[model samples]
Target: MSVWLPTAPCTPRDCAGHLGARRAPLPAAVLLTAGCALTLLGVACVPAVLLLGPAHRDRLIRGWAYAVVRAFGVRVRVTGVTAGEGRSPVGELVVANHVSWLDIPLVATVLPARMLAKSEIRTWPLLGPLAALGGTLFIERDRLRALPGAVRALAGALASGSRVAVFPQGSTWCGRSGGGRFRHAAFQAAVDAGAVVRPVRIRYLTAELHPAGAAAFVGEDPLAASLWRVVTAAGLTAEIRVLPPIPAGSEPDRRALARAAQSAVASDSANRPAESVHH
Candidate 1:
């Protein structure tokens, strides 16, 4: 079992001043053991899919993943999921604020969706296999040559009755302190596909589990320890607020639609802090 260290430089000022005391490193043995077990279990499910077909297998994998996270003590509470109404039957893109790496599994619990993942994730040891099985679409954000094909693939997925999830900010942040500006490529793809854009706001109610902006890999904060932090907090609530879906033609251009969606999420995040409900 390997214990991963935090990648971001933690100066005495950053850690000692604001963030709470740096506790002893978490128990790596338990964390890695559980991670390996879950990975193996996920791998085992691949062959079983031959008997269960693609759709059923996907649901099973998603359920298993969600259960694993919860079992590790990450209690995810969702609100405003009802905002997805009238956006179903496919042809829709769900754009949300990226907070933690946990957002992937958390979102999966609510929507049967495929994600637009960073291309580098395609090579992740255990996660890569599971993501491929779940039909995630990988894109190279820095490679302009690859953007066209990636957009086309996303558009096709939406048209074929698959809801695609994109974190338009293009990076993760600690939602409590706010986030960076969102990129508009995902919105452009939505427009091209004639898909409704569903803006979602994700909030991490707990402190310890909140992401440190510069962490290169999230594994540094052992998954179990972070999950425990979320679970045992006064109240554990990771909110997902899905705002009303904006129709493709509702705005004059993609940029306007993107701004509208961003504004919706920002407003929801502000007005409804306790309950992650979207208007």
Candidate 2:
């Protein structure tokens, strides 16, 4: 298989079990409707929002992302070291593990950047148009020959002072683990652009703060099913851990850099004092 098309062992039947009793059906219905409405509202506003200045656009995107997650009744808790600390304002490669469709907006809440998404997403209903308008970089995962051009496009974006967010794992995994590991291809873009890597780890939790699996969008899981699971799961919390930034040129090659970033993400750093936190 092509590196861009790596698969994960996680399946919905095995890795995405419900954690507890879900929200009352009535409340869940309200959340579901509200979430969809908020998403469509954002899509409708994308064209107008893009017309604003970069700073204004970013703030709007961040706020919109946070609102979308919140609308689904999933509270976001961000912790760990600050992502942009001591780094250049632009050109940082924000990398994270994939868990659900929710990962896109969740990452945007903290690190709003040009997203790197699979070409398949370009055809996905309202999200497709929204992502395109948001300047997402799409990769043709099935076409190995297209890898060079994709990397070049990503590098060009980063080199042009644009922060880019990429899920280097290529595919979403169970939030707990088993996504095969980060592919080095995206890391090459960072290296080429001389960009710092901001590694982030995301987890879903119950109201009591224990691990929750209902949010994982794994094998054979339809988007509707995943979205329903999120909206109905009362008090589902997405805890985003932004690990320390890996300095530019810190690794000799993409492979080493990929490994370094993955190590930081996979490490058990929960007990370590977080540099900051945001609700």
Worst 10 residues of 1 by lDDT: 1-10
What TM-score does candidate 2 get on C-alpha atoms? Answer: 0.94
- lDDT (tens digit, per residue) of candidate 1 on 147-222: 7788799888887877889888776554544465667777788888888888887765434655333221132344
C-alpha lDDT of residue 145 in model 1:
74
What tens-digit string does per-residue lDDT give for candidate 2 at 76-156?
888876534533665889899889888988988877888999998999876888898889999889999999999999999
What are the clashing pairs of model 1?
none
For each candidate, what is the lDDT?
0.63, 0.84
Candidate 2 accuracy as lDDT: 0.84
Instruction: TM-score for candidate 1, please give it.
Output: 0.74
Candidate 1 global lDDT: 0.63
- Badly placed stretches (over 4 Å) of model 2 are 82-87, 268-271, 274-278
TM-score for all models, in order of appearance:
0.74, 0.94
After superposition, the stretches of candidate 1 with alpha carbons farther than 4 Å from their true spots are 1-32, 46-62, 82-87, 207-236, 273-279
